[model samples]
Target chain A: MKQLRHFFDLVARTLFVLSSTPFRMKEFSRQLYFVANGSLPIVLFCVGFAAIVTILEASFHMKLVIQNDSMVPGFAALLILRELGPVVTALLLTSRVGAGFTAEVGLMKTTEQIDALRMLGIDPVQYLVVPRLIATIVGTFLLALLASMTCLLGAMFVTDIHLGYSPAMFLSSMRVFVDFQDLLLAGLKGAVFGAVIPLVSCHFGFLCEEGAEGVGKATTQSVVVSSVSIIVLDFILSYVFSYV
Target chain B: MIEYRGLVKRFGAKTILNGLNLRIEEGEIVFVLGTSGTGKSVLLKNTVGLFRPDAGEIWIQGREVSKLSEHDYLEVRKVCGMVFQHPALFDSMTVYENVAFGLRRFEELSESEIADRVKESLARVHLKGIEDKKPPQISYGMQKRVSLARTVALNPRILLFDEPTTGLDPVTTRAVNHLIFELSRKMKTTSIVVSHDMECALEIADRIVLLDKGSIVTQGTPSEIKKSEIPLVRGFLEEVLA
Candidate 1:
């Protein structure tokens, strides 16, 4: 019951911060730079590998069932757009950006900086949480799009070399099966995961105990909780988006 | 002016401030002296509405602080500033940005004007020409001074200090204490410093209020407190002054 109350409180506060505009625009841009720009290499690398693995597995299964490689692109596209792209990107970000947020805010809490903000008549929620939340939401959405594209390119490269299909053939096959709804589901998953990552990370960070050990603990907990949350939320979102 | 009437605060099962009552007059420097865990810091935090009291009334400058909403508390907080023990300068920002933080958030000033104010506040704390330096790059003493500059730039009516001189060498401690004295005298801001440093209390405080176990053990001018015969007060004074 207490956990539920805190969760509701966080949701309410997040909604309030989202509705209020013109809030710390400079901080928002800085966070966007950190979250989106800083995580690009890792996001690309992770999604690319994930795509290769998915394509290998799907192509092997398709060869056994239909005795051909034609279904590789369609199967790979469906997997990437509906599951691998958004989930992998969010999990990577959960480790990178989400843990970073926890450490930063947790350190601030330990060092009395949060109290300093309040003493300066600045609401810490408005100053700290809002910008990060907005940045994560927007950054993760774009990164998910990037992830989908990278995965497709990776699959195409693998199939062109190994499966005896040209890049154009792979592209056309994917385009035939991968519709706008798949892209929308991926984008929606990214948005929800983005929101969940920061909310959990910041909550743990704000509730961090004192000292260096406390910060370490909060950072670890943030990554673990956010990763678990992303996986669970992915399941629920995929179920919900199945009807669409 | 500030007044705490029967302020009560607790952390979990531990009671920190137990119906503590105290009053601080405007433009006067008051030092709250207490050993560790005696709630001196908690008392200062309560005045700034950082920690709300369980059952009490906190009035600052004729306004009741306990009843104020978060928005209303910000209005009250604008008239007050706190320098924490560890300086608490924003780690990501340079000294100039740290000092300018409050001014940017609370005041409407041109960029040049904000720069001027930041420079002037740093100069007031004798920290001129180090605006580009981050908190970790500076000495601990300079960080504390920067913290002071950051708070003083707001031109608050009341200033609160929590263990302001802790962890400093004797020289830096004296310098910080003297800075507190000078700033209070020059700005005529109501200052409440919580410290275990009896020498600092004697040097800078117009009045000393000593707390022991969540209650005021004694409250008087330095000389009066010096003459107090209460065993706990005398023993504490001896231990701190020795």
Candidate 2:
């Protein structure tokens, strides 16, 4: 519970600094490049496989239960846009980007660079967290949009070959189950999940103890907490999106 | 001038700083000498509002600063610059960029003016022609000097050093100690150094303060501290005496 309060405090402080401080475009661009471009191929490759799995599994289950795989495309598209694209991408990011943020910031703290920053009259929140926060939010949103497109295409391709459905047939059926709004909601989920990553990462970082073991523990805790936060936040967002 | 009045800092049940009180005059170099975990660094941090005291007040230039907001603390930090135990140079930036970071933030200097000041600051620390080198690319001693250069660029009224010579070799240690003395004496800044090196403390400090178990054990000029009979003081002095 104390940890939760500390997390919220970090969020509050980061937001306050974000609003009041001038934006650092150079650092923001650097972080965005790392978040989006650096992780792009891995995110796309993994999500593509997830899409194939979703298509195949949905076909098999529907055929056994209902004796027809006719709705597989629509169901697969619905699942991809609403959850798989954003959540899978985010969990991947939580491991890749979130862990990186934790280790980087944790090292800074252990090395006293954070104190050095404060001594220079530059707030660490303003110098480190703010740029990464902005970059991650923007990058994750874009990645979600791209991941959704890639997953839908992969699912379509799988339905045409494995499920014995044509591409046109898959698209026609998918239109009935999901729409553009699902994609936007998925992007929103990505943005929120992105915001959680740096906050959790940097919070553990600022509170990091000394030594390699301390940094190792902080990194593990940061990853665990961020991944869990993304899942919990996903459920909340999904529940809210259900109405929309 | 800076003063700490009955300062207390606790982490959970462990009190790191207990009723610690000290006064530092303007344009004086004070060495806070203590063993590990003795709250020497904590006192320095609390002075700048990096760590707030659980009880008591900190006054900088007659302004009560322990309660200042982080934004308000910038004014205090502008007057008090700290060099950490580590080099603490930003890994992502070159030495030139690191030194100019503070100038770009607090001063409205043009790019050329900032570059000139950065060069001058680095030169003050006896570093020249390493401007484009990143922290990792340079030697550790050089990195430490660059960190000092970064802090010195701001021309702060008070300078704080946290074990500035901990990991260096004897030659580099003497060089850094001399650099600290030179910077303080030449700049005429009030300097507080947290260190465990009694030998260096005696050489550079105008006043040496010995701390044990989070409180002052003895504080005096070099001759007075050298004459003290306290066991802890004797223990610290054994190496210097040898």
Candidate 3:
């Protein structure tokens, strides 16, 4: 519970600093490059495979239960747009970007660079946490949109080649079960999960102790907490969006 | 001017700084000498609000600073500069950016003026032409010099150096010691150097405070410290003598 409060405290401080300070375009671009560009290929690779597996498994289950896999494309499209794309991309980012933030900031704390920054009269929150939080939020949202498109294309290709359904047939089925709101909410989930990650990671980073072991522990904790947060938030957003 | 009265710092169950009290006057060169884990670095950190004291008052220039907000601490931070134990240069920035970083924030110098000061500050540390290089490309000693250059560029009234000469060679160590003395005397800079360099402490420090178990073991002028029979002082002096 105390740890949860600390996480909110970090978010509050970073938000306060962000409002007061001028936007750091250079630092934001740098962090965006690290969070978005650096992790893009890996996230795309994993989510494409995940989407394919979803289609195959859904088809198999439909055939087993009711002896008709004709609705596989619609069901797969619904699942991918609603859950697989945003949640998988966010979890991947939690591991890639969130873990990196924890270790990097934890190292800065241990090496006294954070203190050096404070001594220079630069708020570490403004300089370190703000840029990262904004960047991850922006990057994750964009990545979610792109990952959803890629997943749909991959699903279409697999349905055509493996399941003997044409791309046109797949799209017709997909449009029936999924709409633009699902994609928008997926992007919204991406943005919200994005906000949680750097705040949680940097909170652990600031609490890091003195040694490689401390940094290692902080990294593990950040990744676990971020991944878990993404899952819990996925459920919450799903419930909230159900009403939407 | 900095004063720590009844300062205490703890980490979990263990106390690092135990009811420590000390005062540093303006333009004085105070060397805090201590064995490892004696809270030397913690003292330096507390002075700058990096680590707030668990208990007691830290008055800097007659203002109680231990309880200041981080935003409030900025006003005090502007007057002080600290060189950390590590080079502590930002990994992503070049040496020039690192040096000019504080100046751009603290002062409104023009770009050319910042460039000139960055060159001059780096040159003072006998570091030339490495301005464009990142810290990782340079040797550790050179990075330390760059770190010092970054601190001194702002012309801070109080300079807190944590192990300022730890990794430098003999020549650079002497040069740093000379620079400390020169800055204190010429600029009227108040300096608190936390170090294990007894020889340099004896040579250049106006006063030396030996700390043990998070408390002051002894403190005096170098000559007075030289004459003291405290085992810790004698032990430190014996190393220099040998």
Candidate 4:
């Protein structure tokens, strides 16, 4: 119960900090650009690869089970949007952006930038943690949405090239099974993953003990927590959405 | 003025501060001098409630801060500003933003007013044109100045400096010492400085207190400290003189 209270207290403080002027829309937009701009090429590349693999695997399994290429497109779309999209996008960010955030904040703590904030009567958690939390949410939402769309496009290309099914059939079949809830669930999961990933990662970063060794510890912890969280939360969200 | 009575701090098996008592008058610039690991920084941390003492009371401007809640401590901490040994400039912020951080937080100044004060603070530190530069791009001396600028920008009534001149060139050390003297006079801000650098301490400290094993060993003016007969004092002087 005490721990639960602390959790709510932390959430309240976090919200208050983010609502402060530093994390206002202008700053949020600036940090979002920093978080997302450099990774567009790599994100697109990874999503493209995941889409191709989903199509190839779907075609192989569908052939074994039903002996038809007509159902393969929808299967690819469902898999990409429902599962592969959020998970793969999360993995990419955990490696790329999450580790970077850990390293940056960890280095700052070790070097005393965090101490400076405390001395200035600014809560390091508020000034540092909140802006970062906001950035992660925004960055992750956009990344996951883009990944889902590109993965769908990649699947279409795969159908045209390898499976010889036209784009129209792929679209119609995808429309039949996928709904607003599925996309909403995927995006919502991404947002949760986004918020959780950086919060966990920065928590490790802020808790760093000393110098270079501490920074390394934070980076390792960030990756581990974020990756494990993505997997566990992915399962839970999938199960809950199944009921919905 | 700040006062600590029967202050005791311990870290697990280690006893850092044991039954210590000390005081500083309203506008005095006092240097708490000690070797490494002698709890110099720990003493500074305790004054502002950064670390809670195991026992005893910390009085800041007649308020017993040892018993203040974290929320109330924040109010007390507003009266004090600290500049760390190493420049702790926020890397995510530009020099201008770093100096303006505190003003933005607790002040109701307009954007243009905030901008003017930030510029004034930077100019006071002689870091005028470098406002747009990141901390990493600057020299260590300049970074220290920027840290000082940030602290002074907050306009605290008390300034806590933890080893303000630990690693700097002689010129930078002199500049920092002069700035300390100037700010203490100009703002009438009480300064609690901790340093092992005898030269820098002697240059800036109106009163010098020496600490050993988490206890005050000796304290006096620079002239008196120079004439002290205590073995620890003589030994320290000998080592630094060598």
Candidate 5:
């Protein structure tokens, strides 16, 4: 019951902060840089490899069942857009950006910087959580799009070299199989994962106990909780969005 | 003005403050002196609504602060500032930005005016210049001074100092004490300083309230506290002054 109450409280606060615009644009921009730009290389690398592995595995099975590789692009498109793109990106961000937010906020709490902000008549939520939340939501959405594109490119490369399918054939197959709804669902999932990462991270960070050990624990919990939340949310969202 | 009536605070099975009552008049400097873990810092935090009492009433400026909501408490907090023991300045920001933080948040001033106020506050703490340096780049004493400047920049009606001179050398401790004295006298702001430093309490406090095991052992003028008959107060003063 207490956890449910806290979850709802965090949701309400996040909405309130999102609507109240123009409070701290500078901080928001800085956080965007940290979240999006700082994680670009890793996102690129991970999505590329995930795309290669998925295509290779799918083609291997297709050869056994149908003795053809023409269906590989469609299969890859379905997996990447609906599942791998957003979930993989979210997991990466949960480890990188989410852990960073938790550790930073935990340090500030231990050092009494958050208390100092309250003493100065500044709302710590407005000054700290809002910017980070906004950045995570927007950054994760964009990174998911980037990941999807990178995966397609990687799948094209793999099919061209190993499966005797040209890059044009792969592109044509993806265009035929992947629709606007798939892309929309992927984007929506990205935004949900984005919101969950910061919410879980900041919640643990704010509730962190004192001392260095507390910070370490909070960081670990943030990553673990965020990853689990992303996976669980992915399942739920996929189930719900499937009907549409 | 501040008033605490029958305040009670506990952590788990251990009580930190018990039925503590005290009154601080406006423009007066009161020092809370006690050994470590006697709830000296806890008492100061309670006054600012940082730590709410389990059962009690705290009145500040004729308002029942304990009943104020989070939003309402922010209004009350604006009239008060707290200088922490370790100088909790934002590590990422420069000295000027730290002092200007409160002013920028609460007040609408031109850039030049903000700069002037930041400069003035720093000067009041004898920290003129070095505004571009970050907190980590400065010495510990200077960091504390920057923290003081940050709080004073808001021009709060009441100031709370929590063990402000705890971990400083004698020279820096004396400087911090002197700065507190000058700020209280010059600004006519009601000040409550929590510390275990006898010399600091004796030097700047108009009245000293000594705490022993979650209760006030004695409360009197500095001269009267010097002549206190309580064994805890006497022993603490002897140990600190010795």
Candidate 6:
């Protein structure tokens, strides 16, 4: 309980420090660009290709085994919207933005900058971690939305060409099964994933020791921990959402 | 004023400060001189409640400080500003922000008031300009002065310096010594400086305390300490002043 109280104090201090400083829009925008904008191409590519592959396999299996193609569009959309979209986006971000945060903070720790903040009466968590957390949630929210839309469109294209289904028919079928709740679930999951990655990455950074070797160890630990945690969280959240 | 009575600090089996007793008056610039690993830094940290003694009492300005809660410790810390061995400036912040960090946090000053205090503190350390520069962009001596500026910005009643001139060249060391003397007098702040350099200690101390093996071997005016006949004191004086 004493440890929990200290953690709460640290979180409160972080919030206060961020509020005291004027928001640096330029810096935040640059980070947002890296976290959201720069990852767009990779997110689109992975999500789009997943759609194509899922449609092809589902159509083939249904025709051969069950003699039905009625649920192909709904199945693909549900899988993409609820599972693949959120998980893939989070995995890419965990590797890219999460690793960068850990490295930057780890270097600062090695240089005694965090100690400097403490001596100067500034809580390091407040000055460094809180702003990054806010930016992470915001960036991840937008990226998940974009990835979901692009995946659905790509699946529609695949159905039109391969299945001889008209674009109008594919669109109408998607509209029938896709609800706003699935999109909300994916965005919420992305935001949660974004929040967790940095928290774990920074925990590693804060525990960093001295010298270059320590930084290498910390960076490696951050990547492994963040990636595994994301996968596990996605599974749990997906299970809960499916049951509900 | 500060007093430590029968202070005992031990790290497992290692004794750092053993049965130490000392007192400081207001506006006195006392130099604590000792060899390396003699617990000078630990002693200084104990004054601000950073390190609690194993069995002792620390009284600062008529208040028992070692047992204060965190909130009260914050208040006690505000009454003292510390200049670490190295200038511990915030790397991401400019010089002005570094100096203004404490003032903004501990006081309810407006932006302009905080700005004025920063300028005044910088001027006190002869760092009038260069507020826009980062700490690393400055010379080692200037970095020390910026640390002083940051320390003095709070206008604390006590200023604790932990090995203020350990790694500087002779010229920079001399400059820092002069600043220490001048600022303590001008601000009338009780300054507790820890150093292994006997020359620096002799140059600025109103009273000199020598510690050996976690206890005060002897203490006197600089002249008195210099003339002491105790073998340990004489040996240390010989080696450090050599």
TM-score of chain B of each: 0.97, 0.99, 0.96, 0.96, 0.97, 0.96
Q: DockQ score of candidate 4?
A: 0.61
Where does candidate 6 clash, by residue pair?
A: A14-A126
RMSD values, in order shown? 2.1, 1.6, 1.8, 3.2, 2.2, 4.7
Candidate 1: the clashing residue pairs are none
lDDT score, residue B215, model 3?
Answer: 96
Q: On a 0 to 1 DockQ scale, where is model 1?
A: 0.74
Ranking of models by TM-score = 2, 3, 1, 5, 4, 6
Ranking by lDDT: 2, 3, 5, 1, 4, 6
Which segments of model 4 are wrong by more than 4 Å? A1-12, A15-23, A61-70, B106-132, B227-231
Query: Clashing residue pairs, candidate 2?
Result: none
lDDT tens per residue, model 6, B1-242: 89999999998899999999999999999999877888898998788766788989998999988887644687888888888776867776799998998888888999999999999999998887799999888887888889889889988899999888877988888888999999999999999999877877776899999988899989999899999998877876897667
Backbone clashes, each candidate: 0, 0, 0, 0, 0, 1
C-alpha TM-scores of all predictions? 0.94, 0.96, 0.95, 0.89, 0.93, 0.78
Task: Answer with 5 or 6, whichever has the higher DockQ.
Answer: 5
**What docking grade does candidate 6 earn?**
acceptable
Q: What is the interface RMSD of candidate 6, in Å?
A: 2.7
Error of 2 at A13 (Å): 2.2
Write down the lDDT of every candidate, Cα atoms only. 0.88, 0.91, 0.91, 0.83, 0.89, 0.83
Kindly report, for each predicted structure in the order presented, the TM-score of its chain A compared with the true chain A.
0.94, 0.98, 0.98, 0.90, 0.95, 0.85
- Residue lDDT tens for model 3, A39-73: 89998999999989988898888889999888999
Candidate 6 regions exceeding 4 Å error are: A1-76, A100-125, A151-179, A214-216, B6-20, B33-38, B50-55, B107-113, B210-220, B224-239
Clashing pairs in 4: none
- Which of the two, 2 or 6, has more lDDT? 2
Candidate 3 chain B: 10-residue stretch with minimal lDDT: B179-188
Tens-place lDDT per residue, model 5, B99-135, is 9988988899999999999999999999886899999
Score residue A192 of candidate 2 by CA lDDT. 96
Per-residue lDDT of model 1, residues B1-242, tens digit only? 79999999999889999999998988999998877999998888888788888889999988888977777888888888899988999998999999999999899999999999999999999887799999999999999999999999999889899998888999999989999999988998999998888877876689999898999989999888889998867876798667
Candidate 5 on A4-35: residue-level lDDT in tens?
A: 58767877876786687565788989999999
